[model samples]
Target: MTCTEEAKAELPSDARPEIKAYLENFNSYDTIFIGYPNWWGTMPMCMFTLLDKLDIILYNKT
Candidate 1:
């Protein structure tokens, strides 16, 4: 799939979900895996949506 220049430039907040699901507590784990197909040298918009929802950044991971 291809995205327009506007979509690519948009922030994660503009991402839309294709399905409804609950995300587990992020603080409960030290490692989180995010998988997505490479589209135009960037991840799909859905991945950005999930990342945007996260309130904390994982730094100094063990």
Candidate 2:
């Protein structure tokens, strides 16, 4: 399936899995490594979902 189709199907829905990995204590680390394949010139919709769930602040990223 295409990214557009997948986004339409998954973005508006809650089918994304819960995030089970963390830094033991999130604030314990000042850095994070997020890796994803560049699909269709951008990260996947699931990545957005994960980012939203993590509530990361873009300004805080270094």
Candidate 3:
């Protein structure tokens, strides 16, 4: 489940825990692919927002 920003603003802090919990279940896959088109040599602001909002450790096992 990927989350996209519908509005150009930060999401509420409460949304983080739920997203972290969801990413924690990613082990069910053998490989996870995160693709993004290069924008000014960086990912879109939305991807960074998603990354910063989640717990990296939960996804570290993969």
TM-score to native of every candidate shown: 0.53, 0.48, 0.40
Q: Clashing residue pairs in candidate 2, if any?
A: none
Ranking by TM-score: 1, 2, 3
Full-model lDDT for every candidate: 0.62, 0.63, 0.49
**Runs with alpha carbons beyond 4 Å of true place in candidate 3:** 1-24, 53-62
Q: Please write out the lDDT profile of model 3 over residues 1-62, one tens digit for every residue.
A: 13344222334422322233435555466766778866445665656656664446444556
Question: Runs in model 1 with CA error above 4 Å?
Answer: 1-14, 56-62
**Each prediction's Cα RMSD?**
6.0, 5.8, 7.3
lDDT digits (tens) for residues 1-62 of candidate 1: 24566456554455555536746667788777778888567777777666766644344345
Candidate 1's displacement at residue 45, Å, is 0.3
Quote the positional error of residue 62 for candidate 2 in Å. 23
- TM-score (C-alpha, index-matched) for candidate 2: 0.48
- lDDT tens string, model 2, 3-54? 4676666645645545566444555667889999875566666677677756
